[model samples]
Target: MTEIPKAADADSVTEPASASTLLARYLHRQRETILDGQIAAGAHDDPDAVADMVVAARRARGALAAHRKTARTQPEVHRLIEELRWFGITVGSAHELRTQAAWLLAAADLLRPRYVRGPVRARISGYFADRTRPAWIAGRELLASPRFPAMVEDLMAEERLLRSTVVPGIDDVDNTAVLEALLERVRSRMRAVESARGEDTRDAAMHGLRKAIRRTRYYLESVDDVAPARNAQACQGLAAVQDLLGGHQDAAVAKHHLMQIAREAENAGESTFTYGLLLQREIDRAAQYSAALPSAYWQALRGARVMADVHLGSAAE
Candidate 1:
């Protein structure tokens, strides 16, 4: 289980116990904020419910206000403290915390201490803590959840976001880092598949394509925000390639699922020609998908004006 970083990790500065207690309360309060929203919405038109809702609504808002103190307990707010130090990100109030949980997690990973120079680490860490944090968190969650159709849509949207944002920001040094990350993600997922075998191994390998596609989408979208805009059409074209591949993966998985159902039927002595035919259709789909994939996205990505934009004052204009 992922540990929720304690606010104390963000600061050595002494805090009032009252403050910590208040923050704890806030988490419980907002944890079911959606449920409260529904209740509040329903109560608005009920004369008898209005009084009760008013009290509940106030309590909810107050809970949020209290949690808004101290950034480190929640990942997003802690990044604003700009202290990569476990002791530096302690947030003091809701006003101090600006980002969300996903950003905080990503930023924490981004700021993992390294042998690199301190200022460089700080800057790179800042990138994840701020600009790309939400996407990183959400993308990781999406990648981990292997629903094929959703992954396909997410992969495509990620591609578009890159063309519009990520590639527009980066430095020459970081551009190399970007390419390395993209390649590494792809290779890592591919390796996951290569290392496994049997029905399980094949399933894992198929899942690797999902992971690769998502990571590729993230790196492209992320770094694009840091580099000068190139030809957007090129980016869209890359997305098209991923789309073809995604369709293949989806069909393959669906066909496999159908086969499982068919096998169960066969155990009872039923014919499964329909399931077999579905599997064939998926196989055909995969072949077509692989055929449509472009050679460019598959090649190593490099040579952008990485530092020409998105470094705050680093925009090359």
Candidate 2:
């Protein structure tokens, strides 16, 4: 575990003590999670380890994003952000494949006892086994990549810089201003989702909405100190919205994978019946989630507005 740097004492602070303390703690936690995640990924212990690493990677990414909003003025910070973004993209591919494998496995298990016979079950098992090999290979390649170690080194160096940098005007910026800025971002993302809905690519649009909801939720969580109750409620609302959209996206991805598997099965002269059946199930699941999306989106928007009016108003006073 990475040691959190000792924060400057409140008595010695030249700015608002509470704000500075919160910022320090957030950055420290971020650094620790990122380091821990890298360590876990490199261990290559078990299949479960991949999921744990992915969770840590996401938390670290969210923390980096939250911190960058205020720290982007520094050139080093800007470069680190871009590097981490690429790093995330690289690892995320493996994560996606792992997720799809899990989804397909669950679907196969669900159909095994009743619908699928021994032959079909064996084929499904074979398909998933082949699919997982590439994910594992990609993960190993990522760990061995020079960029992984470089990112860890850069993060540590940035931590040192954070400890020395005196954040100016911390006392001048009210919590309300922060909340308002975040709320505006949430609204903008909602509009983006709406616009995406009008585009020809529905799957991409739904994926974009899921990302927006995730970012909004992370931003809300980062500001829990500003207004604990309101932030917590808003986070819950956004999370619910995120879950709904995430399910839709997952179904779509699973359907695509199933289609590919069906094609491979046909090429191999194996029965594609089971794959076709699972594909139809995913289609239904996707449709079900899509039908629920409009209501969930509006509810989230209304909740966001209520939070803004209540919390932002209180902060102003």
Please report the candidate that would top lDDT against the real structure: 2
Per-candidate TM equals 0.37, 0.76
lDDT of 1 by residue, 83-202 (tens): 212111111111112222232234334432542222332332343345333533342232234332232233233223322332222211233444444456656765665565664465
Q: Please report the TM-score between candidate 1 and the true structure.
A: 0.37
> What does candidate 2's lDDT look like per residue over 254-298, in tens digits?
888778777777787877777777888988897788788888887
Span of 10 residues, lowest total lDDT, candidate 1: 86-95
Q: Tell me the whole-model lDDT of each prediction, alpha carbons only.
A: 0.37, 0.63
Angstrom error at residue 294, model 2: 2.9
